[model samples]
Structures are given as structure tokens and as C-alpha cells.
Target: MKRVLALPYLLWMVVFVILPVFLMIYYSFNDMSGNLTLQNYAEFLSSNYIKMTLNSFWYAFLITVITLIVSYPLALVISRLKHKTFWLLIIIIPTWINILLKTYAFIGILGINGILNSVLEKFGLMKIQLLFSDFAFITVAVYIFIPFMVLPIFNSINGINKNLIWASYDLGASKWEALTKVIIPLSLEGVKSGIQITFIPALSLFMLSRLVAGNKVVTLGTAIEQQFLTNENWGMGSTVGVFLILFMVFVMLVTRTKKESI
Candidate 1:
């Protein structure tokens, strides 16, 4: 009966998720002539693709680290706040706005004669170019991903046993020591989850790189987009897609917590 109730979901997964992956794998292994070949994979192993992959990883790592640094303190404060729900809602509300809208909003804010530059000019300072740079890309990415990083860490910190903290104090541990030893260790699962959430998507931020960085930044996702849309190289696009799927799986495995047996 339970399986019967899950049929719709199972069918949806088969049709949308499983079928698409299988099709991508099929396309990835076949050339334009539809002949099976390893040329797509070979091309991805070339210097250009390798460099792009490393660039993507580097950016993803930066985004994750920055997001973690900002989010951990914010999440810790929110967890201790009297109005936790309200603060969390504020954090999440931006996510409800369409991503395109958010990106465009940043474009306006980061553009020449935009709010930031206008403020700088008012302060008798030279206007710095913020748009189409690595700084703008990373800032926007961090802004977009902050809520995702915060939520899990907030949950983990909030769920912590207060007794343990008090016990640490009773044992003569300083505030910093208590936080470092007791709270941080327990909250690691949330940090791991946050990294998993932020890093993977950061690796494949195609539209953000295009719009925000103005093609100056070309991550793995941009490469995939180019292969499919601009170059019409579906075989290579599928190869990249296959690699991305593997990367996602690898991240999930690394972040997943193993259950201890009793």
C-alpha cells in the first residue's frame, strides 16, 4: 500500500531524473555521427578543460569558505536570539525572490555610477570598478549562498545541549575555549552540510558568471553552457554534465555522516 502511494513520485523520478541521466550518459559516449566513442571524455581531459575544472574548484572553494566564515557567526548569534524565527525569515525571504531579479539588483548596485560608486564619490574617494570582476562574482555568490549556509548551522547550534556548555564553564574553560571545544565540534555536521550546499552549485554558476562577471569568469558550468548552446556540441556538453553529476555524488559522499552501530 505504501509503495502504491509512492508510485507517482517513483514515476516522476524515472521520467525526469533517471531517464535524463541515462540519456546524458548515452549522448556523452556517442559522437555527432551517433557512433560510440571516448572522444568526448578525451576532450574533457585536455589542458583547457582541466584548467577550467580547477578554476571552478577554486572559485567554489572560495565561495564556500567565505560563506562559512560569514554564516557561522551570524547563525550563532541568531541561535541565541530572542526572535530567532523572525531573523531566520529575514534571511530566507531573499531566496524567495527570483534569482534573475537578485542578479539584476546586484548589477544595478555594482554598475558604474551605481550606489556603491556614488557613495564613494560622495566621500571624495575614487570610484572603484565593481562590476565584471572576481570580487563582484564572489560577493554575489556569497550573498546568494549565505542563507543556505546559515540555516543548517543555526539548526545544529540551536540543538546543542546547554548542559554541555555549562559543564565546560564549570570545568573552568573560557568562553572561547568552550566555543572552540564544545560547540564547534558538535556543529561540524551542519558546517559539512553547508559546504555541500554552497560548494557544488558554486562550481556550476553559469548564469551568475555570465551576467555578474560578464564572461570574464568561465567556470565548468559556463563551459557546459557554451558547448550546448553556442557550440552545439551536445556530446561534449553531456560529457561535462556526466562529470558534474559525479562531482555532486562525490561531495554528497564526503559530507554524509556515518551512523554508529550500537
Candidate 2:
């Protein structure tokens, strides 16, 4: 009976997720120049591809680390609140806005002639270049993706049996020890899920980086988009897309293996 209602969701997922992914894989293996060729993969193996992939990973890693640093404390603060729904709404409200709109709003706040730089100049401090750099890219990425890190960790930590925490305190164990040994260990799934979310969206952070930070700092996403739009090199673009997909799968597999080992 439950399957009757679940069938639509299953069908929806099959149509949207499964089909598109299969099609993308098919597209990746296809090469133009009048026939399908292995040239796409070989071209992607060039130095530029290697460098772009590394750069993308480096930026994504920084964004993930920064998001973790910011979100964990916010999640903790949130956990103590009286109205869980209210606090959740407060955290999630901004996410409802358009991503492009949020990026532009950050630009208005951080750009050289924007509010922050203007305020700094008024105070007679150094007029630093705030926008169109790695810092800007990362800061925006962190702001955008922090919620991904938060929700999973929040759910993870929240699901922990409160009695255990109380029990540890009653047993004369310090709160720090209790959290480190008991809470965090049990919450590992949440942390790992948060990391997966962090890495995945951040891995595809082309639009925000290109929009908020200008076209200066490039990632594999930008490289792929360029191949599709600017260069109109669909074969090469699809090859880069293939590489990005493979990287995501590899990361997910590694994460799954690590979790299973534990």
C-alpha cells in the first residue's frame, strides 16, 4: 500500500536523476569530428586539465574547511534554542532567495566601491582590493554553502540520545570529554554527510566564483562552462564534464569506503 504512494517519487527520481546521469555518461564517451573518438579523453589528460582539476579541488577544500568552521558553532547555538522550527526557518530563509541574487548582494557589500570598502576608506584605513580574488571567491562560496555543512551536522548531533550526554555528566566525566568521546563519535555520519554536501556543491561552484569574484579566479567548473559556451567546444566541454563527474564519484566512493571501514 505504501508503495502505491511511493511509486510517483520513485518514477520521478528515475526520470530526472537516473535518466539524466545515464545520458551524461553517454555524452561523455561521445566524440565529434564526424565520428566518436577517444580524443576527448586524451585531450582532457593535457596539462591544463590537470591544473584546473587541482585548482578546483583546492578551492573546494578551502570552502569546505571554512564552512565547517563557521557552521558547527552556528549549529551548536541553534541546537540550544527553544523553538527549533523558528531557528531552522531563520537559518534557511536566506537560502530561498535566488543564488544569483545572493551573489550580487555580496558584491554590493564587498566590492571596492561597495559598502565595506567605502566604510574602510572613510575610517582612513588601507583601501584594500576586496573583490575579484581568491579571498572573495572563497568567502562567497563559504557563505553560500555553509548551510549544506550545517543541516547534516545539525541533524546528526540533534539525533544523539540526550540521556547519554546527561549520563556522562552524571558519571563525573567532563563535558568536553563527553562530547569528544561519545557525542562526536556517534555523530560521525552527520559530519561525513556534511562533508559530502560541502565538497559536492563547492566542487561545482562556477557561477558564484565567476559572478562574485569576476572571471579572474577559474576552476574546473568555469573551464567546463567555457568549453561549452565561450569556446563552443562541446566535445572538450563534455570531456571536462566527464572528468568532474568521475572526480565526484571517486570522492563519494572513498568516503563510503572510509565510513564502512569505521
Candidate 3:
């Protein structure tokens, strides 16, 4: 009966997820001529493409680290609060806004002639170029994705057995020791999950990079868009997509291995 109920979900995965992945794999290995070839992946070996891929990793790493640093402490504080649900709702509210709208809103705030500089000018400060920079792009990405980082860590911390912390105290361990040795280790799963959500999406952020960074930062997502949309190179686009999927899988496996070891 339970398996019967899961048939719809199984069919959905086959039709949507599994089939698309297989198509991507097939296309990645072939060229426009429909001949079996590795030229699509080989093209990424060029210095320009390689550098773009690395830049993608670098920005994604920075975003993930920043999000994790900000989120964990915020999650800790929120988990201790009586109105946790209310605060979580507040954190999630911005996400309800369309991402494109949010990006444009940031433009209105961060553009040279936007609200921020207008206020700065009134205060006798020179207007700085805020838009079309890497900083602006990262700032928007972090803001947009921080909720993903927060929720998982919050759930992990909130679910911890309170008695364990009490037990550590009862055993003469200090608060810092209990946190470092007990809480953090136990919350590894959530941390890993948050990283997966935040980092992976950050790597493939095309629209925000274009709107905010204005080509100052080139990511794999941007590369994929260029190949598929602008250049109409489906094979190259699928190749990048396949690499991204493999890289994500590698990260997940490594995280799981560490979790099991601990």
C-alpha cells in the first residue's frame, strides 16, 4: 500500500529528473554532427573556460562561508527565542518576493544614482560605484540565499537533545566546551545540508551575476546560459550541466563520508 502511494512520485522522478539527466549525459558526449565525441567537455579545457569555472568555485565558496558564518549564530539565537516561528517567518518573507524583483530592488539601492548614494551625497560623502561589481553580486547572493543556510542549521540546533548540554554542564564542562564538542558535532548534518543548498545554487547563479555583477564575475551558470541561449550550443551547455551535477555529487559524497567518520 505504501509503495503504491509512492508510484506517482517515482513516475515523476523518471519523467522529470532521471530522463532529463540521461538526456544531458547523452548530449554532453556528442556534438552537433550527432557523432560520439568529447569535444564539448574538451572545450572547457581552454584557459578562458577553465578560469571561468575556477572563478565560479571561488565566488560560491565565499558565499557559502559567509552564509554559514552569519546563519549559524543567528540560528542559535533564534532557536533560543520563544517566538522562533515568528522570527523564522520574518527571515523567509523576503524569499516570497520574486528573485528578479529583489535583484532590481538592490539595483535601486546600490546603483550610483540610487537611494544609497542620494543619501550619501546629502551627507557630503562621495557617491561610490556599487552596482556592476563583484561585491554587489555577492551581497545579493548572500541575502537571497541566507534563509536556506539558516533554516537547516536552526532545525539541527533546535532538535538537539537539551539534556546532553545539561549533562555536559553536570559533568563540569564549560558552555564553550559543550558547544564545540557536543552541539557542533551533532549539527554537522544540518551544516552539510545548508552548504549543499547555498553553495550549489551560488555556483549556478546566472541572472543575479548578470544584473548585479554585469559580467565582472563569470560563473558556470553564466557559461551554461551563454552556450545554450546565446550561442545555441546545446552540447556544450549539456556538458557544463553534466560537470556541475558530478561536482555536486562529489561534494555530497565527501560530506557524507565525513559525517560517517565522525
Candidate 4:
């Protein structure tokens, strides 16, 4: 009876998930003439693609690190807050807005003569260019991903056994020592989950690179977009897509926690 009920979901996965992946893999190996070729994969191995891939990984790593740095303390504080749910909801509300809308909002705020620059001008400071730079790109990405990083860590921290912390204090551990040795160590699973959540999406953020960085930043996603949409090279695009999929799977594997057998 349970299997019967799950049949629709199984069918859905076959149609939507499994079929599309197979199609992408098939397209990745075929050239414009529909002839099977390794040319697309070869192009991906060239200097240009390799450099772009490295840049994408670097930016994603930066975004992940920044988000983690900012989020961990914030999550820790929120977990100790009187109204934990309210604060968590506040963090999550921004995610409810469309990502496109959020990105456009940043465009206005970061643009020349925009709110930030106008404030700087009022303070008799130079109107620095904020948009279309690496700083702007990373800042916006961090802002967007912070909530994702926080939620998991907050849950982990909140679920910690208070007795262990008390035991540490009784053993004469300082506050910093307790945090470093006890709390952070136990919450590593949540940190891993947050990294898996944050890093993968950051790697493939095409719209942010285009709209925010003004094409100055070309991520792996941007490369795929250009290949498929601008250059009309679907084969190469699919090849890049395949590589990205494999990389995401690798990240998931690396971050996944192994269960200990009793």
C-alpha cells in the first residue's frame, strides 16, 4: 500500500529529475551536427575554461567563508535569544522575496548616486563605485546566503546538551575554550550542512555575476549561460553543466557525515 502511494512520486522523479539528467548527459557529448564528439570536453580542459572554473571556485569559497564567519556568531546569539523563532523568521523573510527582486534592489542601493553613495556624499566623502565589482558581488552573495548558513548552525547549537557546557565550566574551561572545544566541535555537522547548502549555489550564480558584477565576474554559471544562450553552443553548455553536477555531487559526498554503527 505504501509503495502504491509512492508510485506517483516515483513517476514524477523519472519524468522530471532522471530524464532531464540523461538528456543533459546525452547532449553534452554531441556537437552541432549531432555527431558524438569529445570536442566539448576538450574545450572545457583548455586554459580559458580552467581559469574560469578556478575563479568560480574561488569566489564560491569566499562567499561560503564570509557567510560562515558572519553567520556562526549570529546563529549562536539567536540560539540564546528569548524569542528564537521570531529572530529566525526575520532571517528567513528575505528569502521569501524573489531573488531577482532582491538583486535589483541591491543594484539600486549600490549604484552610483544610489543610497550608499548619496550618504557618503553627504558625509563629504568620495562617491566610490560599489556596483560591478568583486566586493559588490561577494557582499550581495553573502547577504543572500547568510540565512541558509545560520539556520542549520542555529539548530545544531540550540540542540546542544546544556550539561556538557556546565561540565566544561566545572572543569575550569574559559568561555572561549568552551566555545572552541565543546560547542563548535559538536556543531560541525550543521556547519557542514550549511557549507553544502551555501557553496554549491554560489558556484553557479549567473544572474548575480551578470547583473551585479556587470560581466566583469564570469562564474562557471555565466560561462554556461554564454555558451547556451549567446554563443548557441548547447553541446559545450551541457558539458559545463555536467561538470558542475559532478562537482556538486563531490561536495555533497565530502560534507556528508557517516553514521556510526552501534
**Can you write out model 4's per-residue Cα lDDT over 49-142, one digit (the tens) per residue?**
9999999999999999999999999999998899999999999999999999999999999999799999999999999999999999999999
Query: Each prediction's TM-score against the native?
Result: 0.97, 0.90, 0.94, 0.97
TM-score of 3: 0.94
The lDDT per prediction is 0.94, 0.81, 0.91, 0.95
TM-score of predicted model 2?
A: 0.90
Cα lDDT for residue 113, candidate 4? 75
Which scores greater on TM-score, model 1 or model 3?
1
Deviation in Å, model 1, residue 250 alpha carbon: 1.9
CA lDDT, candidate 1, residue 193: 91
Cα RMSD (Å) between model 4 and the true structure?
1.4
Pairs that collide, model 1 = none
Best by lDDT: 4
Candidate 1: lDDT over CA atoms? 0.94
Q: Residue by residue across 142-235, what tens digits does model 2's lDDT show?
A: 8888777889888888888899999999999897898788887877787778888889778778898788778777788788788778976777
Q: How high is the lDDT of residue 218 in model 1?
A: 89
